[model samples]
Target: MVMETIEKVIVNLGASDIDSRLEELLIDGILYAFQEQIMNDDANVMLNEFGIVVNALGQRVKPYLPHICGTIK
Candidate 1:
């Protein structure tokens, strides 16, 4: 399924866009990991430079990212 999405993105947006969106994807993944408390300090460094991931290894990491988290309404 992920491959299919990647293929679609590459076909629709071109392979050149992949590198440009890499940072967005990384930030999204890191945000998800932080929200789920599943990421460790050794595994994340991109946001650490900004002190955005202060509790990466904590049992309950915070969700301070700007993106919206969908929920049943």
Candidate 2:
């Protein structure tokens, strides 16, 4: 499901002329991967590391994600 969303977002970004959309999809992919890793017991260590990285990266990407995702519209 997450991959699908990423693929769709990437496709949309490629088809559209929007830099924000590209940024949004890139962020979403990072978030989705983090979520998936955190949900698995075997990935607990990775999850912790990713949490810090995502938090730092997310701050930079959060602003444009909603517009590209269309979740608010």
Candidate 3:
């Protein structure tokens, strides 16, 4: 529920409008949630929301690629 709301907000705001520090914090929180929920069957919705947030960030996501890829792997 919260993740969905966050995804919507990010999509509406767009990447450029997000402050770097806040973006970093958001990414960190999403990544943490993903890692924690990876093994949970009910995590699909949250995972989807995380993906949308990542996609919405666009190029701003570059710096976190290694961490993101590592998490996905």
Candidate 4:
């Protein structure tokens, strides 16, 4: 529920409007969630949300690509 809400918020805010610091924090939190909850069913939902957030982030996601891809792997 929370991740869905966050995804919506990020999507509504769009990429340029999001602050870099907040982007870092969101990426960190999502990565941490991926690391800690990969075995759970909720992880699937989180992964979906993560993709939406990544798209919402646009070019801002570049720096975190490797980390995100590694976490997904």
Candidate 5:
């Protein structure tokens, strides 16, 4: 399912969006981990970084989509 979604996103968005989408995917995993509240400072830091990157990606992509899109939404 993930691969199929990736294919669809790739087809809809240009090459530049791939990096943002990839980061978005990774951030989802991190956010899940954080939401589950798995203990560990290192894990928290990693998740925080993922959130930061995801935010930046969203800032970049929001102008294009300008609506609900990507893993964050």
Candidate 6:
């Protein structure tokens, strides 16, 4: 699902536009992945690391993300 969505976006926007859209798409993908993971009992422990990484990456991407995207989720 993530790959297909990204492919569609790239097809529409072109590779050159990746610098702007990459973070947006990546965050969207991560959120979906997290949602799936949370549905499993074993995923709770693993998601700790995942959450940390997402938080750090989100801070770095804050500058380029859309104004609303920068808001706390």
Question: Best candidate per lDDT, number?
Answer: 4
> Candidate 3 — what's its lDDT?
0.81
* Model 3, TM vs. native: 0.79
Clashing pairs in 3: none
Residue 29 in model 2: lDDT: 57
- Minimum summed lDDT over a 10-residue window in model 1 is located at 52-61
lDDT of candidate 2 over 1-73, digit per residue (tens): 4444544554454423435665566556555565455355535554444344334444555564564345312
Per-residue lDDT of model 4, residues 1-73, tens digit only: 6688888787776667768898899899888877877457888898899999988887889999998998888
User: Tens digit of lDDT per residue, candidate 1, span 1-73?
Assistant: 3333443454565434234356456446545544554346533442342232223222222342335234100
lDDT of 4 at 3: 81
The number of the candidate with the highest TM-score is 4
| Pairs of colliding residues, candidate 6 | none
- Computed on alpha carbons, the lDDT of every model, listed in order, comes to 0.38, 0.48, 0.81, 0.83, 0.48, 0.50
TM-score result, candidate 2: 0.32
Candidate 6 lDDT, 1-73, residue by residue in tens:
4444554554565444344466677666655565555346635543454444444454555653563343323
Off by over 4 Å in 3: none
Better of 4 and 5 by TM-score: 4
lDDT of 4: 0.83
Ranking by TM-score: 4, 3, 6, 5, 2, 1
Over the stretch 1-73, how does candidate 3's per-residue lDDT look in tens digits? 5687897887787667788999999989887877776457647887788788888888888999999889867
Off by over 4 Å in 6: 1-18, 55-58, 61-73
Clash pairs (backbone) in predicted model 4: none
My TM-score estimates for the predictions, one after another, are 0.30, 0.32, 0.79, 0.83, 0.34, 0.37
The lDDT, on a scale of 0 to 1, for candidate 6 is 0.50
Which parts of model 5 have CA positions greater than 4 angstroms off? 1-24, 58-73
